[model samples]
Target: RLFAEKITGTRRDRPELARLLDHLRSGDVVTVTRLDRLARSTCDLLDIAEQIQAAGAGLRSLAEPWADTTSPAGRMVLTVFAGIAEFERSLIIDRTRSGRQAAKAKGVKFGPPPTLTPEQITHARALVDQEGRTVKEAAALLGVHRSTLYRAFNKQEPTP
Candidate 1:
């Protein structure tokens, strides 16, 4: 009997589940207390069910009778659920993309703030270019890594 009770249902890296699937043979039935106990999401559930079917094994959920993959009707229901899940995921992706675009239009930044300001970058560049100070020395004066100073220098336009 494979048990993954300690692992959270949201995690996909259950060792016991992997072992059970790996050892499954033809005509084997993998019984679970519930469908949620076996998979994190509908997509994950369908993927595991597909693997079981491919191995000629079936899945049966004690709490969800309709989840049995050994019967024709059960297979049909799961297939329909898979289609719905796919459609829902696509809709979510589209909505997220639209929302991100809207946020960008409003001048909302997504990632972390810049490490150094334009003034600091200009000062660092002047120390390196005009004073002939080493990149390392300039970065040390600016209280930043040489690479950070270098990145700042690269991003700004070269002085005429």
Candidate 2:
């Protein structure tokens, strides 16, 4: 019986798998129960296969007959699919960037709006510093978090 090492972790973040791959030698076959169990995505799958091939090793999926990296046809098919997946990801990124640019051109702001306006912040700072009010008191009057009020005050203060 062949002793198979059981590695546990998300396929995307398996340090053990990476170490195993690095130590794999020629004639070594890395076998997995399933294709998805080994790779998080098709691109990741192809990259791992390329690494194995570069190291003179092969990959085999028990559940996926077509995912055999030991065969030329399987390698070609996997490479083609990975290329398609990468192209799709690039298209998605381009569309998202263009969309964000269009929104920016129309004065759309990203992230949460400020909890308190600049004038409110200034007043809050005055209450805490000039009026000798506690940070908690000033924050309560401004209807903001104490940390938020403190952050605004810190930004307005000049270092001694």
TM-score: which candidate is best?
A: 1
TM-score of every candidate: 0.87, 0.61
lDDT (Cα atoms) of all candidates against the true structure:
0.90, 0.80
Per-residue alpha-carbon lDDT of candidate 1 for residues 1-160, written as tens digits (9 for 90 to 100): 6656577878867877888888999999999988988889899999999999999999999999998889998899999999999999999999999999999999999998998999998888888889999999998998889999888889999876
lDDT computed for candidate 1? 0.90
Candidate 1 Cα errors over 4 Å, as ranges: 2-4
Count of backbone clashes, every candidate in sequence: 0, 0
TM-score of 1: 0.87
